[model samples]
Target: MIDAQTLEAPTENPTIRTSRRWSPGACVWCGGTESVEEYRNEPRCATCRHHESVIEEARRFMGMYGLRPIGGTLQSDDDEEYEHRLGARDSRRVLNEIRLEHQPDPELVRKALRPRAAAVVAEGKPAAKRPSTASSATGSSRTASASAKTAAPVKTGTVDIDEIQTRALALLDQLTAIDAQLSLVADQSGLAARARRSDLEKQKATVLRTLAALEKARLSAASK
Candidate 1:
């Protein structure tokens, strides 16, 4: 019964028909709905956001280690994930280096990381002291003399061979891990990637050298 001139096609309500909706407390990174925070305009859970911050900070800190990043945006989720893993790995290495350099007490580091746990551990524990060079040398000589006197010649040789084999196997495993890391970094194009590749190459070379040395020792031991 409507007039043809007055009749118009029904149009969709844009607000009601739109596909995207504002989701509060939803994490884009981990698909979690708890402790969500907005990071770079994207919703992320607290843990995910903390890790993201760590990765970003690590990337910025690489320059201190003489490694520079080639400025580029991540093209895909895979690229972002790769960088995240790399950053975490590098961050662990950096932390280890710092710990080694500073020689901080393990308990202190633990307390610093988890302040709430500090109350549980007992305080005033004496730090262990390292032996002096002279004492260490004397102890080593005494131990070697005792072992030489008490251990059977065949047993000693067998033990030495076993130890050499174990060391060689460990070096091989390390080399394999380094190769895998290198392969991962191969496809990535950036100064940071290049630096990581270089570091891995150096580690591989060192491992190869140690492996060669172990082989030489094994051969010498076999000849004996």
Candidate 2:
């Protein structure tokens, strides 16, 4: 008969030990617990993993075409906010394919993709303050001052006319692709196709506006 202690003894199972050792409690990248998966012996949430994969793919695509990945909100789709935006993934994929197919000059690509955050911020209005009867005059003057500040011309020292022209041409190419996608979805009655059409239309409009702005800016820079 086996003793009670022997019967109660815990067996050292290698498989169980290995599983316990590798099990992840939280995501290694974002520290979130939802949908965590083991990746290369490390735990990562699905979102972070997807982001990593997209970034890796972008880098590989850029490298293959001899283009450097410019780091900025305008150039990179890797931002958290962009990742959450509708059709951002599709835009990145489309952009990558276009870049690979065209293989635009590396210098042109770099110059064309410089950060435009200052201009973007300058174009936006500041938040409104609460109304105050006691300081109406003071508030009016302050508002005027703020308006003046925001209305100040965005510096164009970093902007090159050639770069703007190149960027505009690239955007036109992207717009054509987006239009093609929109055309494909135009006849489809499925909900998914409608959704895709909406995204493509929005992207097309955005690109057209951007191209127009780039043209204006290019003309302005050339004049200067």
Write the residue-wise lDDT of candidate 1 on 1-224 in tens digits.
32121122112333322322224344432334457654543444565555546654544323212123312333222344447447655543332221111122323323333443333234532222112322322322234333221112122112256667777788888989999899999999889999999999988987786677567666766766
> TM-scores, in order shown?
0.31, 0.33
Per-residue lDDT tens digits for candidate 2, residues 1-224, read 22232222223433432232112354432334457764422344565456545654444333222233323333533343244332335534422221111122323322332343234346673422112211332322234334321122223333456566677778888988888877787899988988898888878877776676566666666667
TM value for model 2:
0.33
lDDT of 1 at 45: 53
Query: Per-prediction count of colliding residue pairs?
Result: 0, 0
Residue 111 lDDT in candidate 2: 38
Candidate 2 lowest-lDDT run of ten? 95-104
